[model samples]
Target chain A: MAHRALRIIAAALVGGVLSACTTEPATTGTTGKGSSDGKLVLGFAQVGAESGWRTANTKSVREAAEKAGITLKFSDAQQKQENQIKAIRTFIQQKVDVIAFSPVVESGWDTVLKEAKNAGIPVILTDRAVDSQDTSLYRTFLGSDFVKEGQEAGKWLVKEYEGTSEPVNVVELQGTTGSAPANDRKAGFADVIKGDPKFKVVASQTGDFTRAKGKEVMQAFLKSHEDIDVLYAHNDDMALGAIQAIEEAGKKPGVDIKVISVDGIKDAFVAMQEKKINVVVECNPLLGGQLMELAKKVVAGESVPRRVEVKEGVFTQDEAAAALPGRQY
Target chain B: MTPPDDTGVGGRPARAPGARQLTEHRLFWPAAVLAALLLGNVALTHDFLAVRVQNGHLYGSLIDILQFGAPLILVSLGMTLVIATRGIDLSVGSTVAIAGALACEHIATAKDPGSLPTVMSAIALAVGVAAAIGLLNGFLVARLGVQPIVATLVLMVAGRGVAQLITDGQIISVSSSAYKMIGGGYWLTLPFAVLLAAALVAVTSLVTRRTALGMLIESVGGNPVASRLVGIRAAGLLVMVYVVSAVCAAVAGLMISSNVSSADGNNAGLWIELDAILAVVIGGTALTGGRFSLGGTVLGALIIQTLSTTIYTLGVPPETTLVFKALVVIVVCLVQSPAFRARLSRRRRATAPDRAPAAGDVGARQQEVHP
Candidate 1:
């Protein structure tokens, strides 16, 4: 283990120094001199390849940066906070005009963002946000309203079963434990469900936003709850897992236990079209073009908004089926 | 000045039954874990005893526990063998993703709707992809002598990248009936995936125990120098173990994708290596190498799955479950430690001298120390 850590540290240092020595201005900002010749150097620390949405988001940002003539230095954090911290430090040392990242989780980022800020490198949050109360740490956050998405899912549930007298035994398949999405979605959905005493979350567990884990947790839910009327998954993968469990029990998923989830990935749309899933609240992952545009604006000394909300919406079976062919995220 | 053979038996010979005690020594803690998990679950829920079958499948928390545990068990079995050699494969999770992607690719690209041969070919392609990764891991570790963690980690990062590249960041929905059977099929009211796990366990035990392979592995783990001197072919064994582990992860990936009927490159098998490692550790395999227990690993997987199931069943806050599991694992490790047991017995005798150091006093000492 000691040897392995040394290798990792050595590799990281080499990667850092290599990135630092490249003297040419690889990118240009949108405002000052974003011409092809005058590019603004920007570094992006990604949160590893955690999901399909993440991969798409990373590609979008990279492409957007290229299109905007910004020199983009990319680092894959592999889902570790320490690696991300190191990447940010390297970006700062490189004296890039701008730095941005999709944090793996919400906490443990204040210190690094503060460092970047002190170094005069403005940071932009792409997909996920940090928990710091100081809004001045980063320029702006560009992402979905996760809590609103959850509320939308909840509202849809309330409306769907408004006239029914039967009590709805719902089980929630949450994302990673203590993550922003997990906490926000749980809070948002529970806030709405609190008013209806007839609806109860019979069982809830974290699937960690992975298909295998989601399936495992759903299996556990199937065992404990005999009459789960609805499964509210934090993502479509978990919803898909619950669908398997529902089918394995010789029950129809759409008919026996309704599934409402977030993350309108193409597969989720397909599932919706097939009647395996009932609803999904879309969290647009194609935020790259928007993030790059904002990064350029920040570096150009332009006033960007404190928070730029991505255009996101909810999808029902009908809508999902209709949009399956064109769904990008 | 001469080295005594650790593999030497007590009296008759080095291969005698008494030496079996060496491997058997690690079984107690896993059993205790199983007992604790069962008691905890039964205590938490009144209907834990109820069992039912629905839709030609078993419908109980136990089945749910097993269903969840199957993949963990399969992967941990391989992890146990790998860790038994003082090696870790952080790339197993990504290897799983790659396998799933490969399977998805084969199924998605295949034009045959219901052809059995094409489905078989896809399965072969998936398994072959997993084996190739295993071979690569083996090559890096056994040939290049890179640290198992590092070698696997390179793949861990790059493997998922490759999977994403193959899928083009798309979750390929597999419509093949043959591929679906791997995850969604059943046998005698049990999930076929669960059965597959059992089959792997049975086969692993047979191969490891029925031949000299188990002894060779233990020898390599306990004393690589000595094993090499005795012509044990340590490198070949190391490579073989990692390859086997990779194949197991691939099987898990196949099952996972088949269950969902889609291949997600990003989230196919995320952080599962951690669970597999934890299961191996909880099963009494020393991370430092030279010891392993397959049955104990199976018990460990069950304990983990059951604990998670119990947490959800009892409506415990999801965030606290990890803390609880960490505590339980720590306690189990402490209890299994010989040093802890020695200190405990010494304290027990110091506390009360009259009972000839009660054989069953371990639990009492554990509660006293923890509480």
Candidate 2:
């Protein structure tokens, strides 16, 4: 009886492996654009639906691809580097016209990019860049300048409170520790605000770029510090959380604390409209149309700039009211 | 085993009956340690213990600790029972995500998101789904005889994916006042979350102590084969504990999402299971399973929350905050260990022989054999 059971298990395993192998080639065959239609096939590997910004970015990319009449093979990496690398390899095996991806992290893309390069396929980065040390690995990088976004936030704060001698106690709700956005945003904000003695950061802590943690950390901050003038959050989610915390503490958010944050998600706009948040520095996630254009140009052997910067706008309460109607996320 | 009556061991006298009793009380060290930490916070931060009434609600560091610690207390309470059954549910964190996601998604998509009925239905949906996930874990561990860690791990990894699917990878924000009250609002000048946690704790205690359920669970965990031979129905009890744990996690999820008025699938309850496990361990519940303490777990959760708040109050650098937390946790765990305490006392006795023999001296010498 045991021998028969073992035999059955072995047979089932073999059958499953065979079926998996058979299904793969079928998908590649149908999706492959190596036909007389003369349409450009693009393989886009997305870093999974991690946040509202990412979801908007993915939607934009998908819609733009459809509008541009480009055959897009989309793969969701589920926020794993290995999954992203595997998706890229699958794209290479399928021999798409062009490859593009928003890398999950800054490192570990040298080998895969080299593979795509050797295959004579141009690669474009959207939203996030990689640190491969070899510029030839990809055609160009396209994303908002996170540091510049931070500087703009600082500049806005400076302009708002210009000539005020009273010290402005700023408490920062940073993003996930060690992330590129968190590091660059902190550096940029500090760089712009360092010379001004009136602007002092009383407390800074990582909220891990989440609403719950942001609320919890802000609660702690409120309990610890008696006077907090400004709340500088790395992202809108954290700012929203801090708004809740401030409300729970029985204080006005925008009027009392003058909250400032990054990322232009729709919720941030709603908060700004309600006067709960003071300002939002936009880190635009709608790179799909731009990416589509760049991919087409790269696939056609046209030389593009090494780095492409997407234009973004900072929103005050007034701007938020005007933009809330058209907000996508 | 009766060596204490016959002679003293390791140049120490036999423990006094009162001293032995005190030392054997499992909660003694945990309570003392928690008290010490709270006192330390009071000394370090001015107005740390001050409570003020604001908008007919209590606002202070002490109140904040209980309010914020409510989720950890709930999670750890469930963890204590699971640990008592010789099982670990690493998926509580994921269950938290799924529960919050389901509730927030329901409320966000509802026709009248602010309605009490909508909020009630959303909570029910979240709890029901979480219970089903717990049933799966129990089925895998008890029925299929899978390793507890491995079985729960399946959900630990996949549950976040399920949550993301429910929320469609967006942070669903809702404006339901009833739901918000569950997490962020107050009642009678106290946080609703704390009240809910206290009520749950009381119910859990009454059910476990007033019935044979606790004993049966302990029997099963102590020896599964023996429990089966005695017809203790270990499988059913295991399923019940897991379901209870899932429900607890769901309630915690509700509180968390409600506090922020948003449900983030990716970061709602990240690493909360680890914190719950630490709370369980700090509460004097052995991983090997058998005896447990609900009161100790409450104190453990409070200690952790207080430590976090103290980190900010002390102005620790953001980079070294985690390191500082680790150092304090290590110190607390070391101080709680009977063996470690015994060693310290022994070294002190060796250095100064003139010191009077205290209650711990006899207890410390006896602990050498166990160590």
Candidate 3:
């Protein structure tokens, strides 16, 4: 009994990361066993079901994989880096033909990527990327361009004010402080808006990317600055919150404030259709179909671009009615 | 000068003051800090304290503070009692999320979401689920002998997941005028949320103070073994407190979700538990348990609310807002602390004897020499 316990402890220590599946890829498609079935097996680790967009993205990936007749091994990391790392190591042990994941954060993946590289499993990044200096660790990073989304919002705002040379006093409702999306969106919007001398952001504050804080902060902005002509929110949730505050303050949101927001959620389209929100820039969450295509190409040893930006669009009030019924998120 | 009898765990240790001066009052620091923060806002924006009527309702910065802070006030009110019982309810935030998610999910799925019956049923379902969760928490701590923090932490983490499951991982938006009336409507020129919170706070104060329930709760908190020896049902008291805390959190959740006309399972009531705990601590309630003051907790909640409003009113850049709020909160806490005040008074006595009060502020320090 003592000898058995000792052996088990030794085995646990030896198994540093993954507990390798003993059955070995369900008796087919191990790639090393000469690919008996010729079916490509993909391992995917997701960044938990945190929001509408993330849920949509996960669904897209799952459905696309199913439609493409590929076997998928999916794991949810629950927005933790360690969990993602563990899942990746497990995938490596499982000897998946291709491994893909959305990194919870941008750093601390060098060790795992190196291990995957050693195992010769080509990795693909979906939805988000890692800040590794060694680019060879992953075949491609497929995601939305947040900065471009911000610019789209700003561009719409400029076009709205094109007929008049009147000074535009803008109030910004930012997302959570220090978040990548918040920083990128703010930078992108500022770059576009600064081109016009008549435009100035009069009041700016972090709404922490919630409806409650968005409304509360917007109320203060309306109170402090009575001449606010525009409201640019980093996301749709905040924009919706600010719309309530604007209405409470007896001002029409889309007309009086010319509200422009990012993230084309279903509610945003509803708000746009109701003429409460002027424009919405899409941060596409439907990356599943694209991901499956990329996964197949990488596993087939095709050389893809280092970066692939997801296709998104900018929507106006007129386009809202047509878009709302079919909106996924 | 010396402390009065029964200066329990984490007590002030000094009761020499006869309440002759305004500063001697327990509520003086919080009230003063609230005034100072509002004054700062007023200085920055000339109409910071202004209140006026618009569309047959009171509209102003003051009103907005009460309106926005109503949910926090309700949560903190319940937290005060839980702390009074030598217990903490970290699950209140999760409870908030769950309640909101339940209600929003119900309303969103209903055929006539705008109908009064639909809204009423939605509220009932939400509250019922919250109460059931409270019962579970109470059972865990009272019957199962699990530690309060550990017990509630389970819910705090899993409750959000449960909430996400209820909403199906979506930000469910509902349009119901009847549902909105709970949080967004005006009642007699006041926010319905504020009135509801006020009424609940008042009822809690009366129930705890009017009857012998308050003393029983405090006794159980002060010394559980002694309370048990004295024939007090500590388990019952424990269960009662957790349930009450959860009920308050549920109402707060309703107000928040109703106000926004939507419920976000992931973000609703996120981190509100920390704010509620802070409010209780700032209100001079000791976490080690014993005595509590509902009025003080209300003031603490108001101070926190006012501080946030003042931050926005001042437009103290987006990045520095959190840091600035933290510094102000630290100062408020330092001023409220009796130990800090005693140390400050001792330093002042060493430097300048003429500034000493005849009533003796040094009484708190005198207890330190016995150690």
Candidate 4:
């Protein structure tokens, strides 16, 4: 057993050394040409598929990579910090030209990103940003303005419910606890909602951005509050879950309990069509095409914005009903 | 003389052929809890018994409960095996995401979904990938000597990242009719997911009971050094348990993606591991391991699903449901504790004979002998 253990250790050391020696060619001042042009090997470590928006975003990135003629080496961290670290190490071992990652959480990524930086493989933040104070760890961040998205939802809710009779006993369903989206959205919403004394957020809880959890939380909310007028869900799935809970309670959704949610997913539009949801703030997950383009530009030594914000907007029930057929989660 | 009360012997009789004894040995807790919940639901709701057929399938809130319980059941079955070895797999949720992505990505990437062979190959490949991840988890735990929880933790975090990498952080909407049927289609009068879980339970029971592998696992879990000394290849068994656990998670991922007709790796199996763990724990599997109860796990899964559904049906506030679920978990755990069991037994003796509390708690004597 001692001999076997020693052998395993030896093999791991050799493999590690070999990997360290043969790093993917560094992305110099120029991007690679075509597949025949020695395709730029790009390593992308993604956050797990957590929602409809995420799934679409991943597809977009893969398709964009194919279109751009980049060899995409992908890893799914299944929403864990450690899995992502292992993947990044493996990517460094494979020596990919460039690396990109949508961090699972906001923290615990500084060490890995610094390692990639040290290896001369430029890293880009996709969809989500890291929490490091060091800006030089990564090349640039390309994603939606999550805080702004929350602000938009809050702004719309303020205007929509301006002249209501009963104070809007708004219950906020937060995203995954400790996630960037959850924290940012909470900050943005509270920023606006705090100004209005009448607009009281009676309850707030993490639905973890899941339909089941959203439904569970909503059920509890209905039991506690008799006169909840509005539900500000962090995402659409949570809204959908809340809708189910409302229906089960024999209360008409849009009529009795108004819902304002982000993530203009197809299902949310369908809910809008059924008058279950009142409004949806759009977060364009089609950043993959833009991300791929930016990746190429970054590789080409072309100057890019430090933070590229994707063009997205808020949609009311009327807008949602109009775009129900075209809306993509 | 009288077989030395071999039931109390170490290492589960060390190769005994008493499958019936395993099943009949424990009772009450799970069954009684389930029975109590069912009676409460029936008595509380006006139309709890009402069932209807919609689109040629059963339609009711109860159906929803069963439907939601399906994935939990599948994951818990795998968990049962791992927990039986005094090990835990925290990565099943992530494995589900990876598997779901692989399944949907395969169908979406195909130029023609009509190619049955290609689809089959993709499915096979995805299952293979899931198995490989499982193998890695097993290797870490069994060979590298990492704690099972910590070994699987890496996958739990990185597995979803891998899935997202596959789908490129997108929701891969699959239009394949075959894929959709796995989650959306009905089997007989029940959801296909429920049917799949039921089939898995039966097959798992047969495999564990019929083969020496099952007994070997129990013995190893019960006493690792003794089993190793007896030439049971304990490391190999540990590895197998994790691998099987991952495969089960993959199956669940397929069902989920099909039901939604899309694979969103980020959202595919989020927090599902929590549900699976709860199910395994409630099903009467000790958190510290040794004995596994597939039947109990199923009942536990059903109870959890029903509790969630009931909260919705009964008009509980959405935000409080998490607290409620946490509370239910706490209550169940407390009830299972030895101290609670002893207290209840003492209280029972003071009450009337007919009204004595049901034997829902395992005796302290049994735990001491086993531990």
Candidate 2 vs candidate 3: the TM-score winner is 2
Clashing pairs in model 2, backbone N/Cα/C closer than 3 A: A266-A329
Off by over 4 Å in 4: A1-174, A177-207, A210-233, A237-261, A265-279, A283-312, A316-329, B1-25, B38-50, B114-119, B139-147, B228-236, B287-289, B311-322, B347-371
TM-score (chain A only) of candidate 2:
0.91
**Model 1 CA lDDT for position A315:** 86
Off by over 4 Å in 3: A1-36, B1-19, B355-371
lDDT-better candidate, 3 vs 4:
3
What is candidate 2's lDDT per residue for B1-371, written digit by digit as tens?
A: 11121221112343355655555566777777778877888888768889999889998888988988999999999998998899999999999999999999999989999889999999999999999988988887777666788778777777887888899988988898889999888998899999999999999988987898877877777778888898888889998899999999999999999888889898888999999999989987778776677887888888898888887777787788889989989998998776787888888888988888764466566676543
Per-residue lDDT of A213 in model 2: 80
Q: How far off is residue B69 in model 4, in Å? A: 1.5
The whole-model C-alpha lDDT of candidate 1 against the native structure comes to 0.79
Residue-level lDDT tens digits of model 1 in A1-329: 77677556656744554454233223333443323446677788888765678777877777887787777878888677777888888878777788888887788888888899888889998878888988899999998988998899999999999988788999999998877888889889999988989999988888877666677677767766779899899988788777876776677888888989998888788789998899889898788778878987897899999889887888888886668878766
User: How much is A116 displaced in model 4, in angstroms?
Assistant: 21
lDDT digits (tens) for residues A1-329 of candidate 3: 66566545544533421332121222222243322467777888888889988998888887887888777777887777787888888888877788889999999999999999999999999878788999888899999888888888888888888978888999999899888889989999999989998999998899988888899999988888888999999999999999999999988888888899998989889899999999999998898888888988998888899899998898998999999998987
Q: Which regions of candidate 2 are displaced past 4 Å?
A: A1-31, B1-24, B357-361, B369-371
- Highest TM-score: give the candidate number: 2
- Ranking of candidates on DockQ, top first: 2, 3, 1, 4
| Candidate 3: tens digits of C-alpha lDDT, residues B75-155 | 999899889888899999989999999999999999999999999998899888888888878887787666788678778
TM-scores of the models, in the order given: 0.81, 0.93, 0.92, 0.64
3 or 4, greater by DockQ:
3
Candidate closer to the true structure by TM-score (higher is better), 3 or 4: 3
Span of ten consecutive residues with least summed lDDT in model 1 chain B: B1-10
How many residue pairs collide in each prediction?
A: 6, 1, 0, 56
